[model samples]
Every structure is written in structure tokens, then in C-alpha cells.
Target: MLLEIDAQSQTPIYQQICNQLIIGIATNKLQPGEILPSVRQMADEIGVNMMTVSKAYTLLKNDGYILTDRRNGTMVAAKQSLDPPFQARFSRELELLLAEASIHQISETMIQEKIKQIYQKFE
Candidate 1:
């Protein structure tokens, strides 16, 4: 895993770690069933406190994004189908986003086309 931390960023260290790891998993930069570095080792590499890395790892585990075993350590878990709560969250986010876009005079087609362009770049 390659993690770069910006100590000057406004985001908290643990949050940066959490967000990057999540993106790594979603983008397949980090593979499922791959063991993550130990929290102490990560802390040493990032020059942050061990507790910060531990907190990020804990958050990932709680979110069902990773599994931690005594022998195998932490590995990415299989991606799960969206649960009802997550589906509701997605709907709420889309509604809020559309409302904001309307206020800004942006149409649905404009938003969707922009998203497609961004997704294409990723691909």
C-alpha cells in the first residue's frame, strides 16, 4: 500500500488515512484478502501516532470494509451488496445533490454527462 499524508491539510490524519484506504479498496489499488500493514508500522511510515492508524483501521473494520484476524491481521473483505440503510443514504444524497444543482441552474443531464466524463477518465 502506498499512503501519502499531508500534515498541512485541514482534514484530520485519521480521516485522511480512512478516506485513502477506502478509495484504494474501491479502485482496486488494494486487493480484497490482502493484508494491510500493521498499525504500528503504518504509524512509523507516516510519522503519525499509532493510535491514529488504529482509529482509522477500527473505522474501516466497523464499516465492514476490512476484516482483522489475530493470525492474518487486516485484509479487505468482499464487497457487499448495498443494504437498505445504504440504499436510503444514496437516495437522500442524490435528492440533496439534485436540489443543490437546481438551485445553481444545473440540469440533470448536465450533471450526468459530467459524471460520465469523470468516470470515463477513471476507466
Candidate 2:
């Protein structure tokens, strides 16, 4: 779990932290049941306030990306089946990205190749 925070970014610190953790889980860099650092520990490590880390953790937990237990602390949750709403959101986002690529004059073949490369990384 190497988490980096950009103090100057327009995004909120907690959102950035949540995004990175989500990426880690998606890439399998953080496995299911892997324990995450305590909120205070993560705050100290990232040089952010404990509240920021807690907010990120809270978001992750709410999204079913992580779990918290009184005795076991926090760990990655097992992957769940994607619900219809999640699938719809994913489709919309992919459409927006493809539209942007098209606007930038990225060829269809190139866009497909990039998608393939990224998809392969998850494997």
C-alpha cells in the first residue's frame, strides 16, 4: 500500500486517498482480507489529518471496498457481483472516455489497443 497525496490537487485529499486505494484493489496490489493501516498510522504516513484518512476509509467501507471490525481492524472486502446501477455507471463513464478519445483524434484501433493493454494489466 504505497499511497501518495498531492497537496496541490483540486480534488479533496480523502477522495484522492479513496481513489488510490480503489486502484490498488482493482489491480490486485491489495488482496482481499489484507489489513490496511490504522487511520492515525495512515495520516502520519501520508502527512494528512487523521480525519482525512478516516473519511477515505469510511467511503471505502460504505462502497463495500473494505471492511472494518472492532477486533480485526480494517481489511479489503471480498469482491462482490456488480449491481445494475454500478454497471450502468461504468457504461456511462466508458462512453465519456471513448468520446474524449475520439475528440482528441485517437483512432478506434488505437483506443481498442489501449483498452486491451489496460485490461491485460488486471489479469
Candidate with maximal TM-score: 2
Backbone clash pairs for candidate 1 read: none
Count: clashes, candidate 1: 0
The sequence of per-residue lDDT tens digits that candidate 2 reaches over residues 11-68 is 9999999999988988999999999999999999999999999999998999899999
Error of 2 at 70 (Å): 1.7
Model 2 alpha-carbon drift over 4 Å, by segment: none
Q: Candidate 1: TM-score?
A: 0.81
TM-score of predicted model 2?
A: 0.90
After superposing candidate 1 on the true structure, give the runs of residues whose Cα lies further than 4 Å from its correct spot: 94-107, 118-123
In candidate 1, what are the lDDT values of residues 28-50, reduced to their tens digit?
78888988999998999989999
lDDT value for candidate 1?
0.90
Worst 10-residue lDDT window for candidate 1 reads 114-123
